[model samples]
Target: MSYSLQKKLVIVSFLFVPVALLLLFLLYPSLRLLQFSLTNWNGISKSFNYVGLDNYVSAFQNPDIWKALSNNFLYFGIHALFIPLEVMVAVLLNNKLRTSNFFRSIVFLPYILNGVAVAYLFSYMYNPINGPINALLETLGLESWIQNWLSDKGIVNYSLIVVSLWRFSGLHVILFLAGLQSIPNDLYEAATIDGAGSWKKFIHITMPGISRVMEIVLFLNVRGALQVFDIPFLMTQGGPGLASTTFTVYTIQTAFKYNNYGLASSLAIILMLMIIIFSYFQGKLFKGKGE
Candidate 1:
């Protein structure tokens, strides 16, 4: 065989394993789920009737599904604050202060911790009776604010949103920090020489410089919000009568708890579609901004 032909064959062989694994693990299961979504499979039996689009219709008509979707949107709203907060921290850390490294490590520490551990830690902290938060409030003579954080329907979602923010904010801070480091100091120096104020320099130079990282951060925020399941599940288990039930949590309950695999599959498909649609729009928005 020719040397060039042998090299091409070796490259093709290297690509084959990953491509095969993707098909087997991802594409194949997705196709099966799509098929299963049209049937009445209870996740165990081989015998299931293909019931057309009934599962999809049922999912749309179900009030719980709608509630769960609304909760997902609310979760997204809470997480949206991370962008600005992380950017602010990143910009401050970018200033070569004496304690910048120490502060950066402190900020990024939470993101490296295990999710379940963080959930349990916060669960204890938010406990109504013995948690430090309530204790501190009482110590300060603010007993009026000491209500059940996880059990109150009105405050449960916000409580969980705070945990999510605390856990993930550090990750965005690191991303923004990386973006900030890539920006040339010359741009800021020039702006300063031109008598540009801090706000003006940030608006014109910093914002434009970090636009690419901003796109990635926004996309991750959207995707993470839609697929949020771990913290809420571990901390609350969609408790207080579905007060903080997310779409993914709802789907898991439908499939395993209720033994409605077909319905759960349909819900999953719907969520996937929603993610895809939102992602498409986000891409367009970012592209327009870049232009």
Candidate 2:
């Protein structure tokens, strides 16, 4: 073999292991989940029969699934607030103020903490009787504001959303911060020279510069919102009713709590499809705008 052929062969040899592992671990299980969605596998049973599209039909007809899906939408809506909030923080921090580094670290700290730990901490904070939230409310003579944060069906979803925001908003801030840093300083200087104010400069220059990073942030937000499981699972366990139950939480309950693995697999598949469809449309929308 020539030198170029030998080098290419070596590179291919290095790539083979990771590629095989990806297929074996990620792709194989995904395919298996798709296969199981069509069956009545009780998770422990060695033998199962194919049931065609029955599970998918049942999932659609199930009221609980609808409730969980609505909650997913609510979760998505609440999580969407983080994008603007994080972008604002990122922009403010990009001004290169003296305390910017300190504030950035403070903002980014929660994203690195363990999900379970964060959930537990927030659970304690939301406790009704002695939790700091209630205590502070009473201390400020706003006793009426204190309620069972996790138990009230009306506000439990919102309460959990607060926890989600506290944990993940920092990561988005960091992402936006990086995007802001990558923007050429000359663009901002030129805008300044044109007598453009801060708001106008942000609108005409900064927004366009960080558009790609915003796409990534939006995608992550959507995916995280749809797949929200850990915080709700650890904190509320899908709650005092189905009020806080997300699609993922419902899927877990279906599989393990109810011993309906086939149905759970079906739910998982549906979620996968939703994410894929949303992502595809988002890509198309961004591409159209770019063109």
TM-scores for every predicted model: 0.96, 0.96
* lDDT at residue 27 of model 1 (Cα atoms): 100
lDDT of 2 by residue, 31-52 (tens): 9999999999999989999998
lDDT of 1 by residue, 1-291 (tens): 999999999999999999999999999999999999999999999799999899999999999889888888888887786578889989999899999999999999999999999999999999998999999999999999998999999999999999989988888998989988998899899999999999998999889888888988888888888899998899899988999899999999999998999999998989889889988988887785532
Model 1, runs deviating above 4 Å: 288-291
- In model 2, how large is the Cα lDDT of residue 228? 94
For candidate 2, give the lDDT of residue 133. Answer: 98
Q: Each candidate's lDDT (Cα)?
A: 0.91, 0.90
- Stretches of model 2 off by over 4 angstroms after superposition: 1-5, 288-291
